[model samples]
Target: MTRRTRRTRPSPTALPGRTVPVAGSIAAQSPHHCRTSPFSSRLSYDSESMRCRKGRTPRTLILPLAPTGPMIRRMPPLLTIHFLPTTVESARLAGTVAVMIDVLRASTTVTHALAAGCDSIRPCRDVVEARQLAARPPACPDNLGPLLAGERGGTRIDGFDLGNSPSHFTTTAVGGRTIIFTTTNGTSALEHCRPADMVLVAAFCNIRAVADTLVQRNQPVHLVCAGTDGEITAEDCLCAGAIGLELQDHGGFDTHSHDATRIAISRYQQLAHDSDQLLAELRDSHGGRNLQKLGFDDDIAFACRHDTIDLVPAFDTHSSTIRTLS
Candidate 1:
């Protein structure tokens, strides 16, 4: 039988020419009659009691509490794949690392040449340019004159020391010699990507090295495939896809899922399980078939091998040279 005293709500009080606040409510003022607080945008102070310009009274606006907790940060995608070298726009290549893939021969040959202890490889546009560069007088007595190396129609050019096949660049043959190299597809692809911030050569042989380099640099990447002739070759796309897959497996890159990249990745996934399957797919590719027809079946097998070489070759646009990435 305990009796409790009833609580009453406070009544609204008014000051002269002012609207007083009531329980749980603030006085509302017209925007014209209020001054914005300097400390916060959500706060405002009453000025004088005045009607709005439209002759309407002021209405109250409940300022919501400021949001809390950790802010969400979005990371930009770190990888972009271009199925063909020609697809790379100069504008997009401006500030990104470019990875050029020519697994059928040029990229693989260059990787092997570097691995064989060659000083550097200069990628020239054609056989004539390559020969001219090689015959140029050496700047220093200690410098070995360039070795002319190139292929035409998948055959070793007449009078050139080596073909585009990786086997030709053995340690005893190319060690410490500068190579003036040219090829039908790979060198042109390298030249096309010269405008990029940095250009790195990649092939199945050096895939892991290139992927690790890309992850270490942690920059946006443009994967450019050196297609055969004017058409996209399955080998090039497959190599691009393999590089993308390696990036994904390393777990830091936000890979773009554009149609070309997606197609490459899809093609790679279908053949990634079996070594023989991957090689078979490469041999069936347009470039692969061409190489095989030219009696470069060994080159196709060599190019299809994964992670055999651990060197990352970088193309220097200034000198038009490809050297091992330091």
Candidate 2:
């Protein structure tokens, strides 16, 4: 029988200052503390100490695993507004961000108004409210202290302060004034989405900027197309789809395409071979058809340009007005 000798193991507590011998080293059994390593003096590793030497991982570092996607510090909440095929009803706007899109004129007009430094816009559904508000002195506390503006059948309503035209919303006329606005299609759409957290009036005139604004805000946005008199209009849908595409690209927004929306997006993507082509399409659209008939063909052409302005007006519910969002 062969006699076997027992090997003594090093005592963990016997090691001073939590130091232990590394296997297969001349200094393994030595008590002297050698800070330098054979590999690199600057990269010494004390196995027993469970720490790296000088100029390695810092002690103060608190690194966590990297996140996979974009790290949004403050993501905005979701917003949606139902697009009704018929004329807008006040009930549809309950508790939603109403995006009133009248690509032909109203939305374009409002965009012009804001760009011209109009203080705010109060959208009214009832012409009576607009008339009453307009009749009252601009100093009346009950009113928005706005200039009443609207149109009926593409003509300015009789006895209103101003007409619905992008050109009409100049600094000379609208600067620093609240506009109490109503329109055949635009204000009706605005009234429909009054329930929304933010009501935005958009058009091709400010499409790209509006899209960027929506993404920066990081909210679920809905584009409401103010089609002509209870009928879907191609121009409004095209503008809305342009907005939807921009939102999807920038903010990863998902838009469930309805027939109207889908058609608009498809048509614009196909017909609008380029920016100039897009302008031509806008001029040829149903709303544009009427505009051309009304001899405002130039206005349609001008309003079709993308990213014209960086202004994004957000609806203020308390004041019942639209103000430029910072």
Candidate 3:
């Protein structure tokens, strides 16, 4: 005689159990199948379990509503982008990823210094602290003597080794050097974000590369504009928008941009057809106008070029210096 095994079927009203029929098979036997199962109670699916009512897929019922009437997309929890006219407004960057940009010179110079093989760029808000750091000896084996570098009013600080110009960061001067750098606005912006999770210095010269690094790190990023004397500067806003566009391209996290940010992005897109025109816009920018008056017009021109370098400098708080992120 041959023996046979009989499968058991759970009652329709029974709670989920070991002997429960396969989801589809049980559903096929019930007239109220659409109203049955765990999903019926909550109207949603369990993400972890990967199980849902027989005919429902998680996304089918949870589709997002179409945005209407000047809607701004909601940002995710991890990433946020802020737009401010000055570093003073960036005081809230303490626990976030603060990215400081002074596209006309300071940030570009710092990037150039690191690219030229400087061990580190020590950004100081106080000129006095900058002088003190420059007076101190290097703390590492590869250390070169501290090279004092900074500027006040677009001119080299009296008695300093170098000024805050990208042109001054040539290999002959910055190679194997430890630069104690200070600036009227850029360094102050960096200092404001000193307590951040990570502080980065950016400019048009290294915007794309910096954006790539930020995407890899997947941390919350705040772009701080070192505007001219606490006022809004169009150049910095444009640079911020460039970085914001790249962040959107990377596609992992959401972006929260202010009115300034939206305006910058609009301006950038408008000028995309003619870069020279965009560069010309900088000549009239608040910061650019001040630099020109102070005889640093060349610096503004140099900073407008996009993707001039692949270096991304990150502030190492422990050493109080900006170093190339590996």
**Which candidate leads the pack in TM-score?**
1
Q: For model 2, how does the per-residue alpha-carbon lDDT over 1-326 read when each residue is reduced to its tens digit?
A: 11122122112232221222223221232222224212233334444432223342211212234477754444333434234435345555555455778877888888767766677788888789887766673553334466889788877888887887676776667777888888888877776676766777787656755765665445556677778877777778777767765544343444444454555555656644454455666676777888788776656755654434445667776777777765
Model 3, stretches more than 4 Å misplaced? 1-91, 140-144, 256-258
Candidate 1: clashing residue pairs, number: 0
lDDT for each residue of candidate 3 in 204-258, tens digit (9 for 90 to 100)? 7677677767766666777888886777788888788778766654554455445
lDDT of each: 0.70, 0.61, 0.66
- For candidate 2, give the lDDT: 0.61
Residue-level error in angstroms, candidate 3, position 61: 23
Predicted structure 3, TM vs. truth: 0.72
1-326: candidate 1 lDDT, tens digit per residue: 12122121111121111221212111121232112211122223323321111122222222234468665444644788887876877667878899999888899889878867788888889877776777673452337677888888889999988888886776667878888889999888888887788999998766767877887677788999988896888888887888887666555667655677767877887776655667788889989999989888867766765654556899998877888887
* Candidate 3, residue 165: how far the Cα is off, in Å: 1.2
Clashes of 2: 6
Among the numbered candidates, top lDDT falls to 1
The collision pairs in model 1 are none
Q: Candidates ranked by TM-score, best first?
A: 1, 3, 2
Cα error, candidate 2, residue 237 (Å): 0.8
